[model samples]
Target: MFFLIWLVLFLVVVSFLLLLPASWHRAIYERYSGGRPVACPENQQPAVVSIDVRHAAVAVMDGRPNLRLSDCTRWPERSKCNQECLSQAIQAEPYKPGEVKAGRKQIYHLPVLLAAFAAWYVGAIWHSHYMFREQWLQAVGLTHAQVKQIVWWLSPHLLTAGVCLLFAYGVAWLLAVSHRKGVLQGVLMSVLLCGALIATTWFGIARLPHDLFLIEAGYIALASLTVGALVGGLYDRLVLPSQ
Candidate 1:
């Protein structure tokens, strides 16, 4: 059941990262709604051109924002001409929201690994006897002996570490795709992903005890923030500069 819940949360995080940015990019690109003026490459004639913003936004996730002409003033007559004018349109507005630059596409492994370890450590502490372990055990109605009795090829801690690692990777991927850097950007993205996890938790409110829900939700929130800050901020200030 726990693994199932984690799997669902992972899917939710991925969906949020992918869909949100595409929607945002589409909105930002709406500035080109009426079309922009560009010089036709073939005849050097001035013409109005419309861009396929939706495709561009979706393409941004793949590290390149595709620029294609949906309609042009020279269309029907010269529509088949290569979109050499795309260069001019790009020059007019060089930056697009969520557009990942070639240099920023490389994923820094150190920060992601560190963030995962940190998140897993935080989870360990959160559920330790020194902290809320007693309350959590009570909330879940599980005794330490009962927990020890469970048999599996992988220990629960190992599974948690694995999940944390995957989650950090997901966060890093989103940051890379969006061309976002700095601690603030990392924290913001992490918080958004954490919110998605919390939403899934909320759906089980009726099936779970209130205390258990609170404990699980709180831990997830803290772990997410830790992962985000480390991957986002640490990578920008420390690891990225060294690379």
Candidate 2:
């Protein structure tokens, strides 16, 4: 059955997600620490250097006059060192990629609103007479009168928008954590998340009608894609790295 195929695919996706964290860390390490051993600087003890694509930091070191601010915060000793020493030593703070970029106002209103509207729009289209509304109702064993009773007011709309906002927040958090700001990356992440979450719930929990599940799942994936694209595009333009 179609459901069986999706069930198998969901398992594969889950397995892949389970392995991602380890793989991401390994890739980062391999990229930064080449096969060759790193040699310590003359007269300096060996230290761990945390490296990402943009920067690297030594674990600890004595204060030096010529060291740049970016270099200063990267040193591990900066955290434990005396405040006076640190103040005289470094002018700039540590770089936190997820932190709000310097000089750019943090605003959730836009992404939240955008996501809410998009989600509602997609749901409306998916459930309208133009799409699968009747099929979905039949698959779910609900009559048109029942559907009307459920949507006779704004409560459902408000709830839908609220859920959409929460989902947007989750997407934003993931994109922020990964520090990835691209349409493709966002779309990929959204697809992965949407599939994982919805499939897991649909398969693991109580049985759902196949058509009904498919209808709902399709909307979720589409809405997530829309929200992710919006967030990623806006982030690139709105979030500027410190000078």
- How close to the true structure is residue 140 of candidate 1, measured as C-alpha lDDT? 82
Q: Could you tell me the C-alpha RMSD of candidate 1 in Å?
A: 20.2
lDDT of candidate model 2 versus the reference: 0.58
- lDDT, candidates in the order shown: 0.75, 0.58
Instruction: Identify the leading candidate in terms of lDDT.
Output: 1
TM-score of 1: 0.54
**Candidate 1 lDDT, tens digit per residue, 40-145?**
8787876766687766766665566776877665553465688988877755643344433223344677899999999999987898889998998899889888
Candidate 2 residue-wise lDDT, 198-243, digit = tens: 7678655347777877888788778888988877666545433332
TM-score of candidate 2 against the unseen true structure: 0.53
In model 1, which regions exceed 4 Å deviation? 1-104, 148-153, 237-243
lDDT of 2 at 187: 75
What C-alpha lDDT, on a 0 to 100 scale, does residue 194 get in candidate 1?
A: 71
lDDT of 2 at 185: 68
